[model samples]
Target: MRVAHLSLGDFRNYRTAELELRAGANLILGPNGQGKTNLVEAIAYFATLRSHRTSSDTPLIRAGAGAAIARMKLEAAGRDVLLELQINREGANRAQVNRNTVRAREVTRWFSAVAFVPEDLTIVRGEPSGRRRFLDDALVSRHPIAAGVLGDYERVVRQRNSLLKSGRGSARTVEATLGIWDDQLVEFGSQIMLARRELVRDLGDPLSAGYRALVDGDHGPALHLSESVVDTLKERGVSRETRAEGSQSNVELADVSRETLAQEFRDALSAVRLKEIDRGVTLLGPHRDDLLLTLNDLPVKGYASHGESWSFALSMKMALATLLREESPAGDPVIILDDVFAELDSGRRGRLMSAVSEFEQVIVTAAVEADVPREWDWNRVQIRAGEILPAGEQTSGTPEPKSPADTDPAPGESLSTKDSEQ
Candidate 1:
């Protein structure tokens, strides 16, 4: 699906802004600190419901503002859907679809986008938590309902951990109470684990193909889940060592039934019960799992070269986008590259563009016009100090920041602008 229009109020640096986008390539060109990333972040908010830049929603609302308003007009399969979100600084966020109120999580079901940002390198080079976030985010994008499952699983983990911490010195007293949490943990955690395994299994082929397309070498890119439940069943604390030793590939998780996984999860909890009370933490669950990204039999985190790591991360995203395109009824997920071309070499930049060029829509943000591929006739828009300028506006020299009155849409005026002439 393509974002036909995006409107923002008090989001990031934008006080009030409206951007009109078109199908195929659209480029947002601006210098540093000019809200290029913020623009795309707002569009993606509907898809993932979280910012790629920050872990908290407070930073998304402009300073001194109580809430940030983001409204998107999307088109797919001859349908138009309007998704709106009010990100609050203090209270629960609000959402709407086609002007009808919905549970905030419901907004994700209408839009699907795959964003490639500079931080993606962290997926390969960073800590296990980053990789876990990658898996959970992909799960949400694939099936919006997975968002609820993830939320429930996270709640279960938190409550279970609380019980574990409270029972630190009184194991016998809290044992019965802990059993209730354990059952809840297994119930929700097993669903997450099973969904994750299915996602990893389906991503295998597309990931391999994408890696080959980007690097032109089959470094044999692969995904392996170092599941806490599976590892605990094999041997205590095996999942903890998966990263350091790079032997996570040995864990087999594909085609495991939920009943089997639930039993294993229970066994894992039983295996770690007393130790968990002593440690005051839930020792085994999806929360502790790691998605081991491998290239040519070695873990990407410790062994892959810088270039190889970047390609693997990018390929992982492309693989998800491909999977979504194949399964989604709404059409291909919008491909977003947020200042990503600037990070790649000339060869990879062209290759990356070509790799995603066939999607229904691609929106790119770049500080320099030359960083983007020039042959596709990009629909270009300019941004300056949070203001979105009209189509084809030149930004070669530093431009004075426009006042809010200059760009804000007039009351009842249409936000739609003619598709910028290529």
Candidate 2:
């Protein structure tokens, strides 16, 4: 998919701005805190429905503003589609497709975007939650239904935990109530598990290849889906029986039914009731599951060097990009590189640039132009103190013409001689 245009209103430092993107590579060059990342964040919001930088939406809105609005026109599969998202401080957020109001969840059906930021190194160096989130986001983009399943699982977890914490219900009463949630949880959780398993299975080959290419084949990398449910099911012989079906193995879970998993879940919960009661929280579920990344049979987080961690993180993201291109009907998803070049060596940076060049479009933000490939035919937009000016204008030492006070001109705006004469 290609983003045709983006309009931002009251988003971060951008009071009102519009940008038109080229089909290949678009560069946003700027100093720190100049809202370059904000533009990419707005585009990413269309895909993931959340900001990557901030936990709260309030910070996304301009200071003292009530809400922020992002409008994007996307070209996907030979059709023009419009996506709109409005973030409000108090009320529910609003989403629209083709100017028609739709549920927020429906937005994913139209667009998919993958972002790679410098902080993504955290996936390899930081805590497990970050890696898990990386996997989950990629899965949700590929299978939109997975998002709903995740939401259902989280809801069940909350309700189950609340009941466990109430402390008034008898063991029998709680068991019955817990049984209901366990059934739903296993049903949804099993689907989530299977989806993740399939994703990791498919991604492993590409991830390994990417790692090898990134590091010039000096190291071998492996991606593993570490799951509690899969292990538990295997220990119970369910996995063996399922595998007996040969090519139809995955179908067995659906055929034997969620009821069976639910029964197993109930038994497991019963076995752990005393311990759970003591802890005051639900402990064993998909919510606590993880994705393990190993390089030569060692965890990347504590064991991998800084360069190795960067390679692993970049490989994971590149693998996700490949997956999206394969799965999305909208062609290749737009790539956002947020100051990631600063951390990479010349060879690694060239590899990343080469990998992303096959996509329909790429937008990168960096402090130095040299961070980008010198030969890249990039339409450079220089941002300083939240104002964007074309590279030619900035380099030519000509003052950029003032835009209409209402809306900023799209990227690469030029100053007209007539206006200068006036």
Candidate 3:
């Protein structure tokens, strides 16, 4: 899918700005603190229903303003679709598609976008929660039903935690209540586990391949879904043999059936009830699971150098983009690269540009115009003090349109076409 146009009103630093995008690459050049990122963030918000940078929606609204609005016209599967998001601090956020109001979930049905920013390096070097969030977000975008499973799991976790925190109840009563939560938690947690496992399994090969390509075929990265329940149960002598005979099969972590996982979850919660009561929190479930990233079998957190960590992060983003392209019915997801060009060396930057050029559309933000590939057909938008210049007046550079063959090239294909003389 490609965004044909975007309009912003009272959003961040943008007072009122409209942009028409090209099918190939659209470059947003600006210095720090300008509104370049805000423009892309608006498009991404329409795609994912959340901001990639901030968790709270308040900052998305322009200061001194009460509300913010973002409108996008998208072209997907040869059809034109319109998506709009309105956010007001004191009021409910609203969304619409094709001039019709839609439920929050239905808005996500319109488009999918994958973003790669310099901060994404945290996905590899940061805490487990971030990785888990990344997994869930990707799952929700690809399989909308996965959102229901995640929501259910979170609700159970919250209720269980609340009960643990309210120390006014008797032990017997608490245990009974905990039992109910455990059953529901297992039901939803198992679904989440099963969905995550299958997603990782499907993404494994593509992830490794994408990593190799990003690093110039020099290294392979491994993604492991680490689960506390699976590991905890095995420690408690719950043999795979006994578990396999039940409804769900006790296979590998990625292949563990939801029913089997639910059974294991129920058993683990029962065993850990005393410890949980003492700790005042629910400790053992998908909520505590992690997505582990290893480079050549070593954990990337402290072991990998800065450059390797960046590669792993970019690789993961590229893999997500590729996966969305294959799975999304709307078509290829629009790619947003935010201030990442400055983080890569010349070689890696070339590879990343090569990988991104294959997408239907790409919006990149950078401070240096030289960072962009000169050969690709690019539409440049220069931003200064929250103001966007018209395309022709933005840069001395002229528009260079990539041939159809170049614009729609297959993945891993070389983009070494002769530079168009502008």
Error of 1 at 237 (Å): 12
Highest lDDT scorer: 1
Candidate 1 residue lDDT tens string, 299-328: 888898888988999999999999999999
Local distance difference test, candidate 2: 0.74
Q: Taking the tens digit of each residue's C-alpha lDDT, what string does model 3 give over 345-402?
A: 8888888889889999999989888777677777888876667775447544333422
Candidate 3's C-alpha runs over 4 A off are 168-170, 242-251, 391-422
Q: Which stretches of candidate 1 lie over 4 Å from their true place?
A: 236-252, 391-422
Question: Candidate 3: worst 10 consecutive residues by lDDT?
Answer: 413-422
Each candidate: what lDDT? 0.83, 0.74, 0.76
Q: By TM-score, how accurate is candidate 3? A: 0.88
lDDT of 3 at 327: 84
Weakest 10 consecutive residues, lDDT, candidate 2? 413-422
